[model samples]
Structure formats: structure tokens, C-alpha cells
Target: MKAEYENPFRPPYEFLASGGMVASGLAILALLEENPLPMEIRIGAAAALFLTALVRGRQGWKVFQKKRRLTRGKRFLKEETEIELDDVREIARKNPKKLWIGKGFEWSSTHRQLMKEVQDNMDETKLVGPLPKGEQSKYRETKGAVWVHGLEEEKNEKDIFIPLPDLFGHLLIVGTTRAGKSVFLSLAIAQAIERGECVIVIDPKGDPDLRAAVERACIAAGRADQFVWFHPAFPEKSARLDPLCTFNRVTELASRIASLIPSSRSGGDSFVAFSQRALNAVVNGLLQVGTKPSLIEIRRALESPAMLEELTWKALDAYCVSALESYPSLRDGAYQANAKSKGGKRSKCDIVIGLYRQHVQPSKPNTDLEGLISQKEHPHEHFGKMIAVLLPILDMLTSGPLAQLLSPEYFTDVEREMINIGQIIAQNKVLYLGLDCLSDAMVGSCIGAMFLSDLATMSGQRYNYGTIDDPVNLYIDEGAEVGKHIPFIQLLNKSGGAKFRITIAVQTIADFAAALGNKDMATQVLGNENSWIALRLRDGETQKYLADNLPETTVQYVMNTQGSSSKAGSTEFDANLGERLMQEPAELYPSAMFGKMPTCEFVGNICGQVVKGRIPFIKREEIKQAA
Candidate 1:
């Protein structure tokens, strides 16, 4: 491929040629003055010089115009750049396989110079021009348009794209609220949908525009049936999803629910351990009784002694029936034990317990059943107190529409079709899961956490045994709201090989720290993402984080010095002119520029290439007919 044209940021050769032509013309005139010549010959020579000077000057003027046009900063004054579906189709048609990043040119040395020029010329006070009496300060951020909205156009300014394989490395998008994070996400999600990739969006604090964009993309792709909406707020329209339905082991079910209960700082809280153990026993008991474990069932078993007793008895009877068939002689002993246990006040659990000890425990040694019996025999009040931290989490997850949504009845008929992470991945469906965090934060957080757990579990299964299939694009917006769970980090760490491309958007680095409860862990999570896109950021630490990640460039500047001294009526003057280069020890993209970025503009390090780009707001419309 031919090298792309790049401006050297200096005067072109045409200026030098113009200067030489004028110099030659002047030298000829000087020689004619020194040596006599015919008037006609001198006039002819003068005419030729005049014509040559005019031609050179015209060529120089053209070059100057071209240079000014190339170097001039272009600003997008409109807050949004709207693009129709037809434009998207055209771009897709041209680049059949490229993953569209956004619309802009590659970040080059020329752009760097342009950015520096904008910064050097920046006058913050002048930016609030012609503002009303007291509103100047309110529009201070508008000053950023000098650099944020400023873009330089080159020949053939086209859609910017990164390689499709780069997406598997995952992407992290950081921006403050209303900083075009949603617009970027919408464009990305729509493209993924158009690619027919399995797309999963986990949105905590849902945005309707994001959801509509995905839907329209599906419609445009002729794959509307592949779209599945799962929102806690709209149960009637939302698809039912059972987060607990895809666990391989019963203990996994326990761990999924237990993980939501926040652990103490020491990581050795006795109550937390007890709650996990309790969950394990309950899950085991339910599985043994041929009943699938669900949040409501676990909560009920923990809250009610009668439910635990019933499950324990059912498991014991099932074990006894199987054992009795294998060992016929134990049947008479079991009957005799039950006969001895019969009384008005005596419970059937006591008889089952006696039978298990006499017939099943000695021969088979069902430790799982023993744990269940122990939990049932434990005092209900004490057990509830032990799992007090666990109940509210379960209650939040299984309450109201969530009860049916999270714990869908698999065996029985239900109005909404049940979907699992595994099936969604297998079928390559588009799933939009809205947690509605604004309405009920605790419940929404739990639901989002559980969904991440489910996705993590699915990723593991695919990693261990399943084939590497089409890429799964998972977008988690406001990731800090639900990323408290360990599975989120696990998903980031291990999901790459499983062909899972995870894109996470967060408001700031501190949000991750606050969410994960550790600054280092937040760093670890952010580290997993190979690509970083930064929009408008107002937080100090987040700015520092982004600045640290970006590689530095040598910024060039000119130095001018002059000195004059007069002593004892003798005057001396000296002047010096030199060009100097300095290394910016800090950010390649200035830290302060982060806060001033326009809504739809972004600076990103995508696939090892730093890019300054603008993402247009995608609209559902056809190509307009030309008049």
C-alpha cells in the first residue's frame, strides 16, 4: 500500500521555488545596471522577469491556500452528528468485514500538532463570549470545543475502523454522564447486531435509546426474532431468564446466591461462611429431592423449618427407597424402626431419620443428606439469625416480578419464554437486559450481579468443553453498579479464549473502586480490557488513570531570546533564535482535555493505535430522495 499523505507542518517547496525565481529576477536586474545593454533587450528581459514572477507568485498562492485548508481546525458545533441507516448500509457494503470504530481520521503527528496549536491558542476566559449577565461560568466547558470538537480533515476522510479480531481483546469506555457514552454504545451494539454476532447488553440504570437502537439494528438486519428483551421493570414484555438454571453442580448454585451477600473486610466472617454452608445444604437437599434450586426455594427453606423438614424427609425417603431395593433385608428393620417411632406427637421426620441411620447411613453414608437433616434439626430462629445477611439479598432478587423473572418455572408452563445464558450464546441471540437500577438499586444490582454470574458460568462451560464459536459481544453499561461480584472480573480474565468480547463502560475509575471495594482490583479489572476509549471525564483520578495508560510524544516548540546592555556610553545588543524539543512527562492526550471533550467526540487507544474520533448518533431512516 502507498504511504498516506501527511503534512510536514511547514511551508511547501513551492514557496522556495517562488523565492528563487524572484531572487534570479532581481540579480538579472542588478547585472543589467552594472553593464550597459540595448533598451529593447533590457525591456524584453524585464517583461520575462515580470511574467515569471507573476506565474511563481500564483503557484505560491495556490500552495498557501492548500496549506491553510489542510491546517485549519474544523469544529463540529452541533452537539450531535446524526447518520441515517442508508449511510450505515453504504459503509457496511464498502467494508464488508471491518468492525466500524467511528467516523474520523487516524490520530497522526499532524493531528498532534493541531491539538497543540489549539491548546496554545486556548483562552478560557474568552470562551464564555457574549454570555448573559451571570451565565458565563455555566458555559465554561464550552471552551473545550477548541480542541474537543475540533477535527482536521485529510483527503478521503472516511469511516474509522479497527480489526474484528481486536474486539476479542475487549474494550473499556470511560466517560462522565451525558458524555455520548450511550451514543457510542448504541453505534457499537448496532454494528454488532448487524454483524449477526451474539450480543448481550447488561444495562444497570436502563436507557431507552440504547434499547431502541439495538432493536432497530435487529430490524434492519432482518433478525428481529433474534432480539430478546429482559427488563425487571417490564415483566410482561420482558423475556423470563433463570440465572440459576445453568449451574453444573449444586454447590455452584449455592455459590451464585451466596456471592451476592457482601463479605466482611477480613474475608472470614463466620456468618457469611455459615450462610454459604446453609445454601449448600439447602441446594443439595433440593437436588436430591428432584427439585431444582431457585432463590425463593432457598429463602423459604432457610426461613421456614417446615420447608426444610419436608425437603429433608423427601430426600431421606428417596434414598431409603433406592437402598431398600438393593438391600431387601433392611426393609424389615426400617418398618420396625418406623413402628417404634409412631406416636401422636412424634413427627414423620423422626421416623425417616431413624430409618436413614439404621438402613441408609451405615451402608451408603449419605453425607449430603446428613447435612440437610442437620440444617432441618437446627433451631429456626438461630438459623435465620445466622443467615440474616443472606435473606435480604435473596428477598431483593426474588421479590415481585423478579421472583418469576429470576426463578422461572422450568418444568411448568409460563407466559414468558424462559431464556438462559447458555441458550442465548448457543443460539447467537441478541439479549438486552435492563436492571432498572434507578427504581430499586439493591434489587437491580443483585439481578445484574446474578446475570454476570450466569454469563461467567456459561463462559467457563464454553472454555472447558464447548467449541469456539462466533464471537459474543457483551456490553455492560454503568458496569460499576453490578461489577461488585467476582464473576465480572473472572469473565474479563477468562472469557477471551471462549470468543467473548466484553465491552464495559464506567463513569470513572473511582466508580470501579467504589464498586469492587478495592482500588487495585479496579485496576486489575480495567487492565483486562486491551482497548480504552475516553470521552468527557471530570474526575481527577480517572484522568490520571487515562493519562498514565497513554504513551507520550515529543512536542516541539521554538525558543526566542534577545539581550541588550549599555555601559559607559557603549551599547551592545544580542539576539538568539533556536528550535527546541521537550518531552511531556505526563499525558500524550492532555489530562485537562478529558473534561472538555464534546459529547460525541472521543480519544481512544484502539488496537495499539491512538485515535481521535467522533461517533454520530444513529437514526432509523432511509436515504432521502434528491430534488
Candidate 2:
């Protein structure tokens, strides 16, 4: 029978103390026996020593048994085995239980020297360069490597390194403010850049250190020109990041835009749906009219209620015409005079054919639907409400620097060429959007969410149509600012296979819940993420969230019992042992320990592997060297 226990019957400290007492008592009894003491006293002293020695010996035996079990259960020695960043497998659990893997570096006198030497090597580089000789030599070619942050050592000290491919499925990074999460994110981004992977990092705060690291990495890769930095406030100095650059379809793009509306934060209500429908009409209408409408133009077009109503009928007319053209037979009457003859005048088919010929078969798009809507021929009562829904959203975007961000004319800095998001990703280019939250968070967040949604939609289409073997990562820091973007949340489950990796960093679960507006829904989204790295959390909810993800074990206990029974004047002693099975709750990790986890330490569950590790320290000089 196997038993898992928090506190054993004979703990190490108690066993040691009892053993010491027994040893001293036995020695005194031996001395007393040799000193020719009285028979009664000697016998009594011997009886007490014998009883004491027996009790202590029993406890010591139990302690020795526990030690033996622990020794036998160990698969590898922490001191003998060491796991480097590259040594970590993409799937740790797939490796056999007997696999030789160790937690991170064992801290000792030698490791102290190792850390110091690593620091010295980092500082020695005057410019962006390779790792230290010793460190570089240990590296191996694999999927991709992040730094060796920490080890998982509870069951056995095993090295846990997050691989790039594993995160193609998506990663959720939860940490409070100043919890070293941003540092770890920087470390991960630096590693990806060093690996020559194209990465897009969205920083709401516009952190200088992170920007420097990205710049240094670009220099190291000799692709400095490939790096594009976009700051909304200073649009002239940065790359032009227009969300429309990734627009592929009218309906999808409208949905993405609708999700960015702050009013939709309470969940996609009637207004959100109406806004999406209205935006959809204008976008399709502009394309049909051969106008490459930017957000400014789209917003201007939607301001006219008549234009939106007209566009709606035009879209519906176009759809009906196409359906009839593809299946002309379906348009024929159900009861025809002859099998080969056209439908009768009594049939509705003739009417549809006439309308298609009049409005849809022209060489140019027939967008003259003002008469139809004004006369109340097609648009129902919902038309006016839908148009009203899109006005406020358009107002927010067409106001200030945010307007410039989506304007085609304002994006003329690239020699009148807009940045092609799909091409940038397919060709592998680093694009950084530095939207400083110090001024206003809404602009950065709304734009960032739109950009992410568009990219995910494009990537998913690419996966379905073309082959995408290379992975692309989206790093969004201060994710709370973006809030509940339904499109972005949907990407969590779909993008992994499309080679779209997203790492969302937020201050707390509460923030995420507030953004999502439903705590249960937010938790479901978090659970869908294949990997989670929690740094430190103060609230009990967040702590329990981490603890719930930890590993669970089945424990069996053997209860030993001894009892004395008295019958008449005689006494009989009996002992019985029974075995029972007990289940450990979903909460596997100790919640208390995680709440008390010091800064720079993180507990993560990645690809079915549980890990608790510390973020490796990078000195100020080292940061400068990397930069």
C-alpha cells in the first residue's frame, strides 16, 4: 500500500530527539547495573530504560523506512543531473519517468561562481554578441529556446524550459504589478529574437528596456532594417501600423472592429451586433465602389444614415443576384407549364430574374439604392438603429492621434507604402507597437486589439488555405488595457495550429475578469490556454487558480490499530490493519507556498508539465550589454 502524507508519524526531528534520549537512558542503566545497585532499584531502572529504548527504536525505524522510500523513489539525483535551456524537451511528460533531468542549477559554492562568471560574460560584451564560450558550447539546435528560468523540484528536480513550438498553441502569463513578469517576458522575447523568429511585441507602457533589447537583437541578427517601431503619439518616427492593412473580408473585419468598442465590454449586446452589421455594409460598399477606404473614409461614409441604408440593400441585392446566377434552376417555378420553358408570370422567379438583370448585371457595381431605402422598399425598422450604433465607435477613432493611426494619408512615411501585416509575418519581420499608456490607454488598447484580431483572422485563413510551418508570436503587455475583445479571445483556441502564438500579460485575474465581464468565462478562457506562468498573486482566487493546475496523486493509506479487551479478570490485546484509498483534491500545489513565493520566482504549467522556477537575474550592466 502507498500512502502520501504531509506529516508522518515519526518525523525526522522527533526521531532524532527520541533516539538521543534512548541512548542516554541505556547508558545510565548500564552504568547503574555495573555499580552494584540494590536489586529493586536496578530492576526498576532497567525496566524504564528497556521501555524507553523500545519506544524510541520504533520511531527511528519508521523514520528510516520513510528515508528509504524517498531514496528509492527518486528517479535522478539533483546534484548529478543538470538541465540546461536547450536540454528541455518540447514535451517533458512524454520523456520516460527514468529520464535523466534535473531542476535548474543547484545553488552551492560552485554555482555561485557559475552565476558570477555568467554575469561577467554578459558584461564583457561591449555590443550584442554570442553567449559566453562555456554557455554557448552547451547550446543545441531544437524547436526554439527561452532562457533557463527555474526548475520543477517537488517530485524530482527537473529542468523546465518553455519552447517556442509548444507556445504556438497559446500562453497565458498572469502576474501582478512589479512581479518580475515583464522581465520574464523580455527574456522570452530576447530569446525569440536571438533565434531569428519574427516577433511582434505590443507594449502599452512603451517600456524603454524592452525596446532596447529588441533593437539590440535586431543588430545582432544583422536585420536592423527589418525592425519596425510604431508609436501612436510620434507617428513620423515609427512604422505605420494600420489595422486595415490586414483586412481580408468585410464581415470578419467589421466583427473585429465591433469587438474593440468600449460599449461592447458588457458582452456583445444588441448595439454590438448592430454596429457590426452597419460597419459591414460600409466596408463592402467602399470596396465595390473601387475606393480603398481607410478608417477615416469608412467613418465618414457611415455618418450618413442614407448611405448605410443604401449599402445594406446593395449587399443584399448582390447576394440574391449571385445565388440566382449560380443556380438558375432553383429560381424556376415549382410548377412550370413545360420542363424546358421559363417560369410563368405568376411565379416569383421572373421577378427575381428581372431585379438581378436591372441592379446586379451591370458592368459597374449598381450602388444606387437610395430610392429603395428612402421609399421603405427593403430596409426594415432595424436599419436606423444599426446606423446609430456605429456612430459612437466611429467618433472615438476619428478624433485625434488615434485617427492618424488608421488614416491612409497619415501612413505615407513608408514611401506611400503601407505595412503589409501578412507579408511581414510570412517574411519574418519584427514589428513593435509602442503605445505609451501614460497619455491615454484607450487608444493604444483599442488599436492593439484590432491589430491582433486582424492578424489572427489572416493567420487562420492562411493555415486553412496555405501551409504555415513557421510560428509567429504576439506579445501583449498590460493586456488589461485591451479588455474583453471577443475576437482576440476566440484566437486563443484556433491560432495555435495556425502558428499564431499569443502571450497575454495582465496585472491580476480580477483585471482579466473585469475585462471579460464574467469571471467564469474568463476562467474558461484561461483554461483553454495550453500554458500558464503565474509569478505572484495576492488574492485567494488567483492563488487557488494556480493551485488547481498543479499535479494530483492517488494515495492509499494502511491504518494500523491496537486495542486491549478485558473479559472477567483477564486482558487480551489484538491488532488489526486496514487499507483504504483516498483521493487528493484538485488543488495540488500548496496555496500558501505560492502566495509567499518571492519575487523573480514563478510557478507554471506548460504542455502537461508542472514547473516552479526563479527568473534568472540579469544585472544592469548585462542589460546594457544586451541593448
Instruction: Name the runs in model 1 displaced over 4 angstroms.
Output: 1-80, 89-97, 121-143, 146-151, 326-345, 410-413, 565-586, 622-627
Which regions of candidate 2 deviate over 4 angstroms?
1-159, 262-268, 304-389, 409-417, 553-587, 619-627
Could you give the C-alpha RMSD of every candidate to the true structure, in order shown?
6.5, 14.4
Question: RMSD in Å for candidate 2, one decimal?
Answer: 14.4
- Please report the candidate that would top lDDT against the real structure: 1
Give TM per candidate. 0.84, 0.62
**Model 2, span 42-160: residue lDDT tens:** 66776786677678778777655543332222322222222222222222224322111123423222222222223333332222234456654443311101111211123434455
**lDDT, candidate 2, at 84:** 27
Let me know the TM-score candidate 2 reaches against the reference structure: 0.62
Best by TM-score: 1
* lDDT tens digits, residue span 1-627, model 1: 322333333345666776776777677677786658876687677678767877877877765554344323233323236777656656665765666767676666656665665456545434334645774444323334543333354444556887777877899999998888898888887777767789999999878978888887778777788889999889888898888888766777777877788875523778878888888998888888888888888888887788889888887888788867754455455556657765654466777787688767877888888888888888888988999999888878777888888888733666778888888988989999999999998888888888888888888777777667788899999999988887888889999888888999999989988988888888899889899899889998888888778777655544445555556755665555544443343357777778877676788889788888877878756423222
Quality of model 1 by C-alpha lDDT: 0.76
